[model samples]
Target: MKKIEVVAAIIQHDDKTLCVQRGPAKFDYIHHKFEFPGGKVESGETGEQAIIRELQEELRLDISKADYFMTVDHTYPDFHITMHGYICPVESREIVLTEHIDAQWLSINELPQLDWAAADIPFVEKLMAE
Candidate 1:
């Protein structure tokens, strides 16, 4: 199985977290599912750097810094993933979605209502538990 290293930003602003819906994928399980905004980590890039760059590229959202959060390791039928989560505080919820189909800023309490990708569920659970 292929292993992927990814970073996710739990972008927060005005007491809401940013969730982005993925576009169509080869796998039905993940397609169109909501997820924390981020992408894969490139070789030689730190997890923080990866998140910062990914957010800039994917959402056109600039974040000065990201605090370290928890890491989640999950395996799907096709691939395995080790995801690093970050707590990124932003000034605004505004974003230009270049990759995702839709985006939402929902309170922690409301996060569970969305259909989320399996890999992202752990992050949601942790956030809602807080």
Candidate 2:
């Protein structure tokens, strides 16, 4: 089995967290699931670098800083992922959605109401506790 290592940006503003829906999935289980926007940590890049790059490419938002939050290791049916999460506050700019199908800034209490990727559930749970 292949292991995927990635970083997720838990971007927040004014007490709300940004969540984006996956653009499309060939697999039914993953389609439309809400998630923090981010991408894989390419070789030779730190988690911080990865999230910064991913956000810029995926959302067109500049991450001023990414503070470490939590890490999640999850095994799906076909792959496993070790994900590093960071609490990223963006620079003042409008978000341009480039990859996700939809996005919403939801209250922490409402975070769990939407369908989320299996790997992101623990991160969301941990966030709600804060």
Candidate 3:
């Protein structure tokens, strides 16, 4: 089993949060599922750094700061993941979708309506509970 570490950003703009949809995947469980924007944490980079870099790379969106949130550990049939979540407030909702196939800005209450990646569901539940 391969274990991976990643970071995710709950990017808030005004009253909505950004949600990105994956294009496709080898596994049906995650294919086209919605997820917060972020990616694998590179060597020597903090969770914050990884998130900032990921957002910039994947969305062409720049974020000035990231506040620590919570972490979720999940295991899938093919891999295990330890994901760090962050609360990142952005001034603009504008983004260039370089990787994902779709993007939406939905309020916290409306988050659960979308089909989400398994690891990302915990984050959605937490946000909706707030």
Q: What lDDT does candidate 1 reach at residue 50?
A: 99
- Predicted candidate 3 versus true structure: per-residue lDDT over 13-118, tens digit per residue: 9999999999988989899999998999999999988998999999999999899889999999999999999999999999999999999999999998999999
lDDT (tens digit, per residue) of candidate 2 on 5-82: 999999988778899999688867778899988989999999999999999999989877999999999998888989
Off by over 4 Å in 1: none
Q: Spell out the clash pairs found in candidate 1.
A: none
**Clashing residue pairs, backbone N/CA/C < 3 A, model 3:** none
List, residue by residue over 1-130, the lDDT tens digit for candidate 1.
9999999999999999999999999988899999998989999999999999999999999999899889999998999999999999999878999999999999999999999999999999999888
* TM-score for each predicted model, relative to the true structure: 0.98, 0.95, 0.98
User: Against the true structure, candidate 3 has what lDDT?
Assistant: 0.95
RMSD of each: 0.6, 1.1, 0.6
Provide the overall lDDT of each model, using Cα atoms, as 2-decimal numbers: 0.95, 0.90, 0.95
Compared with the true structure, model 2 gives a TM-score of: 0.95
Where does candidate 2 have its weakest 10-residue lDDT segment?
A: 88-97
lDDT of model 1 at position 20? 95
